[model samples]
Target chain A: MGPITGEQIAEKLSLTRATLRPDLAILTMSGLLEARPRVGYFHSGKFPHQIVAKKIQSLLVADIKSVPIVVSEKCSVYDAVVTMFIEDVGTLFVVKEGGLLEGVISRKDLLKTTLGGQDIQKLPVGVVMTRMPNVLFTHTEESVWSAAWKLITHEVDALPVVRKVAQPDGSDGYEVVGRLSKTNITRLFVELGEGN
Target chain B: MGPITGEQIAEKLSLTRATLRPDLAILTMSGLLEARPRVGYFHSGKFPHQIVAKKIQSLLVADIKSVPIVVSEKCSVYDAVVTMFIEDVGTLFVVKEGGLLEGVISRKDLLKTTLGGQDIQKLPVGVVMTRMPNVLFTHTEESVWSAAWKLITHEVDALPVVRKVAQPDGSDGYEVVGRLSKTNITRLFVELGEGN
Candidate 1:
C-alpha cells in the first residue's frame, strides 16, 4: 500500500526481516523507495530510466562535437565534393573569410546536382547549398540531447556548431567552431555503451 | 577500509548511525557498497557508468531496426538514386530473387558514380554496389552496441539486418529483413535521453 514497515513486508512475503533488508536497501538507494528511520518505506516516484536520461542530458555538445570540414561558398561543387572525400564527412559547412558560416551542403545535395547534368566543375556551391538563415545550428553549451533532437526533428544529417560574432557591418554572424552529425551521435552512443 | 559496520562508520565520522542509514542505503543499493548482516559493508567495485553501459548493451538490433529499402541488383544507378530519394533513406539494400541480399549501396556511392559522368540510366547498381561477403551486416539478436560499433569501425552509414536462410540449392544465403542506421542510433539516443 502507501507505506509498509519492514516487519509487515517480511510477514507478507513469509521471509525474515533480515532476508528482506538488503532488497529494501537496494530499492531505497536506487530512488525507487524512500526509507525513514522510524517511518516505513514510501515509493519515491522515480524510475531507473530517469537516471540514464539525467546522465545523458548532462553532456554538452562541446564535449563531443567533431572538427567541422569547411568549404568556401564560391568553391566549385566538384572541389566541394573533393573536400568531402578528403575529409570523409557527409556534410560540409560553406564558410566565408574568418570561418563565418555561409551555408551547408550535403552529399545528397551534390548527388542531386550531379544528376541534373549541370556542369559541377563550374557550379559554385552557393547555388546549391542550404543558405545561412535556413541552416540549423547548435551552440557549444547546448546539451547533446537537444542537438540530437534537432538532428532528428530537422531530418538533417549534421548541424554546424557555431559562435555568434559581430560582422564589420554590425550584423550578427555565426562562426563555425565544430560539427554535430549523426556519426558523432552514433559514436557517442557507442562510447556510452562501452562505459567510457 | 575492507569491511566495516554502519555503527563503526558512523562513529568514525562522528555521526550517529541513524544519520548515516540513508546514505548507506543509497551506496549499498547503487552497488557502490555491499551490505551483509553481522559482517558489515564492503566495496562492490562497481561504477555508475557501468549501469548505463549495461542498459545500452542489453538493447538488440531487432528491437530498433527500421524497414529496409531494397532494389534489384539489375536496377539502374539512376533508378537506385530515385528509390533512395523516394524512400527517403540514405542507403539501399540490393537483393536478388527470394529477397536474398546481393549488395549494398549508399548515397556516397551514388554520388561518386554520378560524378563519374557515366550514363547513370544504363549503369546497373550491381557495378557500383558493395557486393555481398564484403557488406557488413547484423543479426536480430546482436546487441545494438556491437552493431553501432560495426557502423563506426566499418565506416558505413547503415547495415542490413538479415537472417540466414537455407536456399533451395543447399547454400546458406542472408535474407534482408531490416536496416540499422546512424539515424536509428541517434533516435534511440534521443529517446533514451527522454527517459522513454
Candidate 2:
C-alpha cells in the first residue's frame, strides 16, 4: 500500500485501533515506516540497523579523541619506550618543532626493535617509526566510525588525529592534535552500553 | 495524563488525529510511552538511551571472542614475542596441560622487560606474566559490555575467555577458551557502523 490509514490497518488485522497504535508507533520510530500528516503511513525504506549506524557515524573524532602523546624523532628508542610507559599509551606521534607530525611509533615497532638485539639506547625512534605519508591518520572532522574502520582495516592500534598546516616548503603538514585508538573505541563502546 | 486517547491528545494540541499519529508513535516506540488496547498512552518510565544500552548489554562474549593464542610456561620471552608476531596478537595466555590458563602476558609487559636489559632469550615468560588469581578474566556467558568495561578499567589490552573446570585436587581451574581484546571491540564498533 502506498499509504494506509490506522483504522484500515486495525480492521485488516481484526485489531482495535488502540491495539494497533503502538505497533505503528514502533515502526515509525525505528525508521522502518514514515507517517505523514493526514496521509497515513508507508515504508521509510530504512532499516532499524541504519538508525544505529547513523548515530555512530554522526559522532566525530574530535568528540572522543584522546590527547596525543608525542616524542621527537631524535628521541632514543629507550626514551621512547619510557615515554610510552609514562604516558600509558600504545602509540606516540613523532613530532618536530611546533608539533608537526613527522612519523608514528607503536609498541609493536619498539618490541620488534628490542627483539632485534640492537642498542636501544643509541637508536633514535625515527629509524623505527612509520614515517609521514606512510603513517595512517585521521582528522578531527572525520567520523569515529571511519576512524575505527581505518584502525581495523589497517591493523593498527591507533591513529594520530591531525590538522592540516601549511608548511614553510609550501607543502601540507599535519599538526598532531590528538589520538584515536582501540582503547578509545572500547571506551566508547562501554559508554554506549552504559547509555551515556 | 494517564491513559489519554489519541483524539484527546490531538484536541489538546489543536491538531487533527491524523497529524498526531506519528508523534505518538515515536514516543511510544522509543519506550517513553506505553500504548495499550482501549487504554491509550501512558508514560513508560524509560529513557531512549536505555534501548541502545539494553541491545549492547545483551551481546555475550562467546559470540564475538577471538581464538586464544597460548604458550607454555617454560616458553622464553623471546619465543613468546615471536609467537605474538606470528599470531598477530597483542596478548598471549600462558597455559599448561589440558589447556588450562596459567597466566597472561602483554606487549607492554614484554616491552618493559626488554628495557630492563635482561636476557630475554633465557627469561621464561612465566617470570614476567601476570600470574593466576591476579589475572582478570571473562567467561563465555558474560556480556560483551561487561568485558569491554573490564578492558577499560583494568587498562589491559586483552582478557582470556575461560571456563571453570574441576581439578583433581578438588580445586577450580580455568580452561582457556578464547580471547577478548580492544581489537574485538573496535571491530564490533565498525560492524555496528556498517549496519551489519
Candidate 3:
C-alpha cells in the first residue's frame, strides 16, 4: 500500500487515533512502517519476520525508550542508592542543571562505594559515576538494535536516550529524555508475542 | 487446527524436519502450540500478540531457558569475578561439587567484596552470595511469564531454571539445567516481532 494517513489506519481499526497511537508508534519503531511529518505512514515493505535477521534495526529508539530515572550529579551516593531501590531500576542517569546527560551509575558502583566504608551520604554520585566520556548513550532516532547491542557489549543494564541540542557555549551536548533497558525490550517482546 | 505433527509443519514450510525442530521448540516455548509425548503437536489457538497479557503462560521454562553460567561455591571471589566478566553476565550461580546451586552472586556482590579490601583470592563466593532461602528459581515445567515476572519483581537480571530431582539424602532439591534472563525474553521478542 502507498502512504496511508493515521486517520485512515484508525478508521480501518475502528478505533480513535489516540487509542491506536501507541501501537502505531511500536510498529513504526520496529521498522514495519515509516512516518513522515505531513505525508502519512507507509509500509517499510519489510515483513515482521524479516526483522529478526536485521536485529530489529528498523525500530527506532523514540518508540521504546521509557522515562529515565535520574539524579542530579550533585546528589549523594546514599540518595542515589535509595533512588535506585525506590525506582526499582538497575541504572540511574546523572544529569546536570538543565537535565543534560552527565554520567551513569550502576549497583556495582554504589556497592563499591559502600564497601569502602566511606560516608555514602557525603560522597557525590558524580565522583562515583561512570563519567560522560565512558557513558554509552543513544539518540531517539537511532535503532533499538544498536541500543540493545550497546547494552550487551558494554555489559550495562540501561542506556540514556537523548537528543543532541546546542549548548550555550556553542558546543553540542545531549539532553536526556528517556531511558532504555533490557526490561523495555523484554516488555516489547512480550507485547509482540501476545500479538497485541 | 486439531492435532498436527512436526512432519506436517516441516512439509508445509518446505523445510526438513531436522531444520524445523528448533523453531517448533521455540513455538512451543512461546505457547503458540503444544507437544504431546506420542500424540504429536496441537495448536494452542492462542495468537502471538495475546502473549503479553498472559505473560506466555503456555510457554514452559524448559523451552526457553539457556545454559547456566556457573561457578563453584568454593571458588575464590576473584575467580568468580573473572568468570562473570568472561561469561559476560551480571550474575553467577555458585554451584557445589555435583553442580547443585548453592547460592547466587551478582556484580554488586563481587564489587562490594572487592571494595572491602578483603583478599579476593581467599574469600569464597559462597560467603558473598545470596544464599538458599533468598534465591529465586524456576521449575522446568513452569511458565516463562512467571519466570519473567520473578526477574522483574526481584529486580534481578537472571533466574536459575531448574528441575526437581530426588537427592541422595532422601530430600528433594533443584538441579540447575539452564538460565532465563532479560536477554532471553528480549531475544524472543525480537524473533516474534520478526514474525519468525
Candidate 4:
C-alpha cells in the first residue's frame, strides 16, 4: 500500500536476485528507485506513462520561480552564460519585477546564439531566446504528459506551469509553479521497471 | 498498400468524408501525411510512426552554424541580444572557429543574470552560459527518439546531433545536423490521435 520493497518487487516480477542486479543498477543510476540495503528498494512513487506526459493539468507558475535562483530580464548574453555555469542548470526562468512570467532561456538557446561570435558581454539574452509567441505553458495540476507534449510540439524544451493567481482581465494572477520535463518521467519509469 | 484515398478512408473508418477534412488538414500541416490534390493521404514515408511521430531524427550542428548568426566568446553581454534578434532562433550553438562545440545560451539564462543589474553588458557570455560537466551529444544515425529521450532524461531542451565527420583521436567525430524538438512530436501525435 505504501512502498514496495526489493524482495516484494523481485517476487512480483519473477526475476532472479542475481539477474535483477543489473536492472537495479541501471534503475538506481537513472534515479528511478533507491536501494536501502536492509530496507530493499524504495519506489519514489513517480512512474509516468506516455498517457500522463500528454495530459494537461492546472499549475502555478510562481511555485517554479520560487526556487532560489538569479532572476533577470535584461542582462548581457555573457552574464547568462556565467549564471548557467555557476548554478549548474540547463534552463533559466525570466520574470518581470512583479515576477510576471516573461520567458525562459536554456542551454541550447544560449549555445545557438553564442555560435554567432558576437560580443557576449554586449548582447542581451532577449535577442536569443524563444520569446512570447514561441513559449508553451501549462496550468498546475495539469498532466505531466500534457506538459511533455507541449515541449515536443513547441519544438522547445521546458514548460512554465502556471496557475491563474489573478488574471488582469479576469480574476487570475498567472503564477509559475513546477517545471516539468521528460527526465522526470524517465526517472519514475526506471524505478518501477526494475524492482530488483 | 499504396495509399489510402479519402473515400476509402471515410468508408473504412465509418466517418463522413467531409468530417475527416479537418484531421487531414492538421496531419498535412505537421508534415506527416502527404496529399496529392485529392490523391487521398499517403504517409510521409520518412520516420516510422511518420503519421504519429514514432521516431525523432537527429540535427546537423553544421547546418545550424550555416544559418548565418554571430557568436562571441569574448563580447560584452549587451551585444549578444542583437545577434539573437537577427538570427530568429530560440537558442544558439557556441563553438570555436575550427567548429569545436563550446557552450550554449538561452533567453532565460540572460534574463536571470541581467535582472539583478550586475553590469552584465561588460561580462562575457562564457561567464553565464553552461560550461563543462553538463553537455550531452548525439550521433547522426541515432533516431530522433534517442535525442528526445536525452532531453527528457537530462532535463534539457535540445541535443547536438553530431556526425564523426573526422575524428582526430578516432574516438568519434560528430558534425551537428537537424534540430528535433518536442513540438515536432507533439504535432505528429495530435494528428495520429485525431482518428476515432
TM-score on alpha carbons, each prediction: 0.81, 0.83, 0.62, 0.40
Which runs in model 1 stand beyond 4 Å of their true positions? A1-45, B1-44
Full candidate order by lDDT, most accurate first: 1, 2, 3, 4
**Candidate 4: which stretches are off by over 4 Å?**
A1-196, B1-72, B88-90, B112-119, B131-134, B167-173, B181-196
Best by DockQ: 2
Better of 3 and 4 by DockQ: 3
C-alpha lDDT of all candidate models, in order: 0.89, 0.89, 0.75, 0.53
Q: Candidate 4 residues B1-196, lDDT tens each?
A: 3567888777654669788676566445544457887666775543212312331232222322223233657766566765665664444555555555566665656656555456766888778877533557665455545555665676564555544566577753334454444344344333322322
Relative to the unseen true structure, what is the C-alpha lDDT of residue B12 in candidate 3, on a scale of 0 to 100? 54
Candidate number that wins on lDDT, 2 or 3: 2
DockQ of 1: 0.35
Q: Show the colliding residue pairs in model 1.
A: none
After TM-score superposition, the amount by which residue A102's alpha carbon in candidate 2 deviates from its true location, in angstroms, is 0.6
Q: Give lDDT tens digits, candidate 1, residues A95-135.
A: 99999999999999998888888899999999999997999
Chain B TM-score list for all models: 0.80, 0.81, 0.71, 0.54
What lDDT is reached at residue A133 by model 3? 75
Tens digit of per-residue lDDT, candidate 2, span B1-196: 3577877676654669887687677666555578998878876755435656766788899989999999999999999999999999999999999999999999999999988989999999999999999999999999999999999998999999999999999999999999999999999889988887
Q: Tell me the lDDT of model 1 at A190.
A: 94
Q: What lDDT score goes with residue B63 in model 4?
A: 21
